[model samples]
Target: MSFIQTLNDAWSRTQSLLCVGLDPEPAKFPAALNGRPDAIFEFCKTIVDATAPYASSFKPQIAYFAAHRAEDQLEALIAHIHEKHAGIPVILDAKRGDIGSTAEQYAKEAFERYKADAVTVNPYMGFDSIEPYLAHEGKGVIVLCRTSNAGGSDLQFLSTSDGKPLYQVVAQLAAQKWNDNGQLGLVVGATFPKEIETVRGIVGDMPLLIPGIGAQGGDVEATVRAGRTANGAGMLINSSRAIIYAGKGDDYAQAAAEAAKKTRDTINQYR
Candidate 1:
């Protein structure tokens, strides 16, 4: 199956668009796992075991593992998620993009080396930066359209002399013109619901990777109302620290599951 099909299939099974972000910040880990690499793996294992049932898929932010020089350890974490959740997709949230040859190597590392089912890439480098990822059959290449940050407006909303904002231009390309292969997805901020609707209009039925639901203080209710299609599908609302660090103690995994359930149930209400 292709990446879109795989993610949609998972959505069907879970009845959810919730993508739990397993960003294991060392500072937020349980006291037991504070400085231990093995503890980080164990914590991820516990959280995956606890929250997999409620999640449509899992997104492990690459930076968290990279910060600790624990890239190899991430394989173990992904393996654990697969073992426990079976077909649930794993999206490596690296937000990578580069020019030409460098892009190919990055795609190779993301898909072959890491074996992630999906990855987030930046579109600023143009289609050449994303073309390398299209070779991975059934893998997702999500382009960063509008990110979730206060400073995001710095470039994303800049108006061209042509009158369209920069991100709208990105949406037009990522949705209609640039998707030579069907493996494309777009990243839009949940914090910006009106922008979500605007981009949704541009993308049609393409799956959207929505960040900033929990930790970044995005309004979940508003995002769901705007980002959902007629059937309220095709959107993955991601929550990381809000879910993972809910308790920050021994019951952290359980807290994470509860947080995921709250998010899922809340979105289901609008669905």
Candidate 2:
């Protein structure tokens, strides 16, 4: 199936819009697993096993694995998720962007090497940097639009000559010109609900991968109110630290599972 079809199927099968971020920091691992070369993988495996039932998708931020030189572990985790929970999609959050040959290699890394169903791409270099990823049939390329970080306003919110924010211009371009494959999506932070609503209007039914909900203080109800499509299923609300680090003890996996369930249900309530 195509990336969009796979994602929609996962959402329907799980009845969830929650995308658990498998960003394992070595420092945050449980005491027993901390400092181990394989701690990140072990922690993520347990978290995925526990939270898969409540998740529509899993997003593994590549930096966490790359920082520790755990590429093998990252590959293993994706394989494990595919093996055990075939219905759920895996999005590799690499945010890669470059020109020409480099862009092709990044696409190869995300879709061929790591075998992710989707990837987050940086759009600063414009369409050519994004086209390689889109060239891969059935793989998704999610462009970074209005990010959640405090510094995102530095560039994204700048007013263009037409009185439109840079991000709004990006939204218009992405929706109109770059989505030929029908696998395009935007990363709009949940922290910016009004922005989410505006981007939603621009993109129509295209999916939005929203972060900053949990630990970052983004309001869940506000996110749902602004991000959801008319059918109430166009957004994937992500929570990382809040769910994964809910506990530091032996029951960490259980705590993460409970947190995932609560988040999924909370999102459902507003839907």
* Top-scoring candidate (lDDT): 2
Question: What TM-score would each prediction reach against the true structure?
Answer: 0.97, 0.99
**Which stretch of 10 consecutive residues in model 1 shows the poorest summed lDDT?**
32-41
Alpha-carbon runs more than 4 Å astray in model 2: none
lDDT of 1 by residue, 1-271 (tens): 8888898789889998899998887777889776664877888888888888889988999889898888888888887777778889999999998987998898888888888898999998898888889877888999998998988899999997889999999999988887877899899999899999999999998889999988798998899888888767899889988888998778887898899899899988886
* Clash list (residue pairs), candidate 1: none
For the record, the alpha-carbon RMSD of candidate 1 to the native fold, in angstroms, is 1.1
Q: lDDT for model 2, please.
A: 0.93
